[model samples]
Target chain A: MAEALNKAGSYFIGLVRVIVMRILIAEDDLDSQTLLKVILQKEGHEIVTADNGLAAWEKFQQEDIHLLITDWVMPEMSGLDLCKKIRAQKTSEAVYIIMVTAKEEKQDLITAIDAGANDYITKPYDKGELIARVRSGERMVSLEQELINKNKEIYSEKEKSEQLLLSIFPRFIVERLKQGEVVADSCPDVTVLFADINNFANIFSRKEPVELVEILGQLFSVFDRLVSAHGLEKIKTIGDTYMAVGGIRKIRRL
Target chain B: MDSNEKEKIVVSVDPDFEEIIPGFLEHRREDIKKILEALDGNDFEGIRIIGHTMKGVGGGYGFDAISDIGRFIEAAAKENRPEDIRQHTEELASYIDRVEVVYE
Candidate 1:
């Protein structure tokens, strides 16, 4: 059963990972453009081709491109220039760029890296190497997406925990608790009220435990709402009793 | 060789080449024209641009010859060698003219 559950869990994760990305290939040469499109399409990625950096930039603006595989040199703009422009954009998601070039100089590689390309592939590229680099870019893009999702999850969980904390204590007290402050205070102008359900033992003996608890729950909820409506702080509910404090001023009355 | 005999450089590419090769060939033709124009004007920058693009893009499409010429032209342009640039451009033009793409 445990093995089956683990398998099901992994299957669900795989289902979630079936996100097909739109990848843009910016290469001026026909042969390279065709080669990239064919290889990436085979990997189940939607391919968009551009003959120059300018065209690639235009496509990026018009479409939601998740990955870019760009050559270094073109007519209107270089791939390095494109990468810099993309990095400068204030986008919510990061666009992964893989620079494919025949420039094997160490300085050229450094320049590509500095321009914000996530990865690089050299020319006379082996098919396996090109695919692997693209896969690496995909992994980086997906990992960033996963981090954003995790951040949202964390934010929601924090909000939920705050709500739970608010349910247990007054807002001021909760804030004080968060700040690690002790909250024992003497308020002179406070009115403490305590009330208990009358003839409780007789009612409990006549009703089933579940029914008795349900009645008590309903009764306490009404009392709690009434206390809140009157700007009173409900201190605690002890079995059949409800305790509240009103006019809880920190300073004494003049 | 006659015009018919001169068109025998056949290159076999993947099946999807049909959709791209026509447009690619057209682009290459344009590049050759531009290179000639640049050579006439002694525009080393223009020649370098074409050469750089070719260097980056040629080999991936199964045209290593174009890539080699591109590399030579790029280097020659950087050194401002007009004769070398012209020679490399002619070689690239020759390759493009004779090369035939066969989709597998």
Candidate 2:
């Protein structure tokens, strides 16, 4: 009895925790909208319906939509218009939009593509074709999302790796290498300036860790400003020390 | 595919909003259900992972309300509270139910 009760309770709990992906469907045709709702529902996907392009755009703004399947034409606005609107949003993330239209003219395809429709499907679509298309969209969208996420991760990792590399070597060396410079070639009479904070250990011991961090941050900021102002290159920072190099420009003094 | 209708079909500047509302609402329901199920399974880990993933993409697709709920769910899951886990899950469902998507 206890085991059965626990199992039932767990199942109930499980039912409550299901994660659903939202989909927005914008079709002006009543029959098409109904058909889509039934189809998506059969697939265990929740569906939001819009009869016109404007309404779809509204629902798109107000809802949590993962994918959008829209018709090409309707009253007020068209699928192309909605797609353009979505793409125009300043902070807009990519929305998977599939434009289902009756018009398949070459010019029509071009216009849809220009308006930012992710894919185009013609009307009188086979049920199998429709499902395949939707799944294809799902796969492509998931893949596209995966790519976007991976790219973001790669970018951040690259940025962090760059920062770590910067900490280990001189910026000039890093930049030179980045700009395809070779270590085999040596520039003559390079002036290097290494500055260490005075009594850094004593000052650090007397201050809070936060205060020390703030002080160090302020100090580095000043160093950066000075280096940029004097047209010098910052090599690296080690503990409380800052290093720079100049004299590449034929200056007489250090 | 009416040929007569094709000739008169001149695209307009301001699109119709009513036509798309039902479809959007229906889709929102489907999405929220999946997320909730993942949460109810004591898959707080899944909830955190999926919620965080959804939060990043929700804004792009114009689903700010869902994104907001996702953000809260992610926060609650990260804090690792059983009560919070349950609370945020319920809140997420409620938001899914009540959210009104609009354009402008």
Candidate 3:
């Protein structure tokens, strides 16, 4: 009998050390918090503890907490509130929240679920049950991490697509394309026109070289508009002279 | 409709709104506010500067309607034609009123 009992004790001990999860325990009671931390640490899991939900949230933001083992009630915020906040972020990879409550009624379980907890463990709980619950939570955390990785990949791909779109067209055109607009087709009978600025050298003949460039920019804005108004394509610009072409859709050269 | 015909149709059926209505509305409102302020001050030079910038930017975005209005404003400002600018300003305001930015 003694040998069997000793073997069982060793087996339970081994089970605790084999599972690796970073758990954050939110319990206001000092002794309870320490006990839970020690229990989880012995199981080969890293432990973080907060006396209230607010502190837990702060810790959550600062670190990658895989599982939350929180009391049902605490100062600052309740465990339910914490779970709700975590789920709402959607940015959080996925976290397994197991509410540690003294309540045993069906209503309590319903409340926990509504608030986003994945599981619940009753107080005065059996050590074996506690360990089993945690192990299950580890599985949930792994699944969540997978989802997080997938979301990251999607986000990165979206950024790359935006960059490519920006390079190909102006931001407005890119936005139109993103909205599913058919804007790239050629306009039928669209006339393109080009115009060159008059007096290629005379406009800047009397001004300093640097001032000439600045003045030219202000002056050339006029021609740029006239061409745009007539739907003329600006083929190129050479110093004081600007060249634009008209007749793209329906050839009407001007 | 076949895939090709469906693809030919503009993504946004609304001739005015092409993409992200709320985003564009917010941007245009802000820009129009600045243009109005510049106009009120009898600052044709400032009007020309602002209108010219809007013309290029609006055109690039495929908001041809807004771009054309911006060009009109730019032209009037360049020629110091106050009456033409006043008429274009009203047209621009009407365009803004016509625009409906869908939240969805």
Question: Which model scores highest in TM-score?
Answer: 1
Model 3 lDDT tens row, A1-254: 22323311121344542224668998875545654665576677778889999999999998777889988767899999999999998665567889987555799999999999989876545446777899898877766666776988999999999987774454555677788877755556544444455675775578898997887777668877887787665555567666665655242221
By TM-score, how accurate is candidate 2?
0.49
Candidate 1 residues A119-210, lDDT tens each?
88888676678888888887888788778768888999989988888867777777777778777777767899999978888868888889
Clashing pairs in 1: A31-B61
- After aligning candidate 2 to the native by TM-score, how far in Å is the CA of A76 from where it should be? 2.9
lDDT of each: 0.81, 0.66, 0.68
Q: Which number leads on DockQ?
A: 1
Per-residue lDDT, model 1, residue B84, is 90
Best model per lDDT:
1
What TM-score goes with each of the models? 0.72, 0.49, 0.45
DockQ (model 1, Cα): 0.43
For B16-90, candidate 2 gives per-residue lDDT tens digits of: 333544564465456466656766676677667545644533433345555566577777777766576567657
Worst 10 residues of 1 chain A by lDDT: A1-10
lDDT for each residue of candidate 3 in B14-99, tens digit (9 for 90 to 100): 32233334554456666667767877787888777556545543433345566677678888898988778878777766666565
